[model samples]
Target: MSEDDRTRAMRSPGDGRPLPQRPADGLRSGGAPAHRMPGGGPGAPTHQLPNAAPQGPPESGPKPGGSRVYGRERSGSSPIKPLRSRREPSESGPPSPRGPGRRISGRTVLKIVAGVLVVLLVTVVGLFFWVNSRLAGIDGVLADYEGRPADTPGTNWLLVGSDSRKGLTAAQRKKLATGQAAGQRTDSMMLLHIPEGSDKPTLVSLPRDSAVTIPGKGRDKLNSAYALGGPKLLVRTVESVTGVYVDHYMEIGFAGFVDIVDAVGGVEINVRQAVDDPKAGLKLKKGTQVLSGSQALGYVRTRKGGALPDFERTKRQRQFLSAVVKKAASPGVLINPFTAIPLASSATAAVEVDSGTGAFDMLSLGLAMGDSPVTTVVPFGGNEAVPSGGTAVKWDRMKALALFDALKNDKPVPKDVIDAG
Candidate 1:
């Protein structure tokens, strides 16, 4: 076709109009109609084309359309040329898609998404390394066991029985006035449970003298399980007593326990009784008392609260533990980094975990227990001594098992259990 015919075809269909001349630098030039306007021609300042379109309003975000359109600054001498997206067609034809300023590829968007993913990956890896470094005694000591979760209805822990004989210096021994009996029996024993519920927990307090039918050694007190066959025997005895699978065990000695409590700046206990244990050399008047490791061990072991049954000792154990939990959770303890980390490290060092559980595994368990209610298991008929020997106290085995069962079923213990006098 001739150039004249081509120009005619490009003219606006709305009015029988001649096509305009093309500007050399304009971004959009449809055939011949490159420069037509209200005032018409080369130097006549007129609205040649509408401004470029902006992106739509974002979800929950402010719109930029009005700002982009109305506030656009117009150069006085420069002729307005349409950005292809905003070019108005006067019944002529559709504008060509590609203009110099219009986006042609999604390169910017792709780069942004990739950058975000990189940041997230780095954050995750940093957190993992920080937690790993904080865990002590877990590096090569535990191998052949990682990525394995403890899968059981409940968890059983065989807390350690330390020979306190080592903790006593010559002066300490003389102060207690025993002149070093070969080795006093283990002082503390406990089992912790993480049952299913908001505040549901079952703890069975075992007396050092509660006799039980041992696996191979016949009948003896439960504490004998540790001295006889070690942790394995303790696990088996607790299982036989409670009927729940023993998932894991941990043990700590007297020195270790004291070190840990001291590392955390000592634990606070609210005592209703003035504790004056001649054996432990703990002489503290009743009130809210913060005791060091040596003093803490004594307070928990004191049986001077009562004359006969020694039920007062058990009650004090629960009281002291509850106070420790509350104080440890308070900001004074949590924010004190020097005290907190050392305490955590010292406690972990003293604690010998179950064969399979690792540092992360143990951390998860502690986190789960943070909000759960913790209580010591109480015997049904308080504590009674053997008919002949007063040193041997008979623990209610059936009652202890019942308490554990209640925890497994996610049921609350009887109100009487909590309100025991």
Candidate 2:
């Protein structure tokens, strides 16, 4: 070989120069010919076709680090483009606030609480209307008397307890020891007066045997008006005698009274003395005792033996009525729907109210009674035998008038009237 050709063949491949061609036979130490380097050496030109029709896929060949991706060898400049998975994000850092696995905040909890409260309020309101619709309403139970006393300053409610066995079954009658009374009569009567602006409520019990002139039936026992013309005449008679207007009237009968007592479980009362009365089937010992429905019925009905029979009985009726109000308003009954719903149903079904009395009026009466109002029986005067073979009660006229006046004018009842109890 010539000196210059030999020098070219000995040059390193890094010189970016082509190797000198070998002899026709082969390299001196030879086997097969060596492959050409990529990005051809300096002496060899880099061929470029002018505006080549987007060249087809490059030919396959072995690479140094890994298999060739296209025509280019795997290198730092030529990255292996990763194949994307369906679940992986296109570009990533951290998840968004509304994305999966977000934490709950206080505002969210408050919103949830508010939503629940609104739902409960709506439910309670709906339930109230449904229950109010169930009330038993009456018409014209109040008399339309032109001579009726003028309306007074406070609200007046005349509450009556009747001895009516109209709805009692044979078993119930036997259980309650109530003989089958053919007709209804007032066994107990009272007036509850509530003055405006938080004045104390006064509960005045009217004796059934009070000597009063009935509007149509003159000079009869107070209870006789109820038997003759029902509630209208009774209210009329009371109005004429007391000179105090009757704003609302409420009454309950035997079966209904018993059911209400039982529905509230029972009423607790303090009895100062022991009593055993076979006529009313009331057997009780002194001290406080909780009376069941049947026992309580007898307690209010018995008027046999006491200092004054009917007067003492009226006191007991007042006590029991007050206890009933307390029990119906108690937390255990009011907070539990099971107890509250049935008790309200029993009370509304049991009572007969005047035409003007609405559901709200009844509820207001109940709440007022629950306050443990000042309870007193009418001032007693004397007892006289009647032509009808029974005795009539006479009221202490002047004192009674003063008591009614205090109530009519919304004044505190005279201490004398209260002390008389």
Highest lDDT, which number?
2
User: Candidate 1: which stretches are off by over 4 Å?
Assistant: 1-152, 164-185, 329-332, 368-374, 380-391, 417-421
Tell me the tens digit of each residue's lDDT in model 2 across 1-421. 9995775556637675765443323222212333334655534422233442322233356445553444445533556676787556558675566667567789999999999899879866776786577666667777576877888887999999998888889988887778876888998999999888677799999999988878867777899999999888888888889888889998899888988888888889887788888878789999999998888999888886687888888888999998988888788987677888788788877887876777678778878888879988789788777656677988888789889999889888888997675
Clashing pairs in 1: 160-251
CA lDDT, every model vs. true structure? 0.57, 0.79
lDDT per residue as tens, model 1, 44-111:
43233445332122234324332222234333334355465454443465445564445545888899
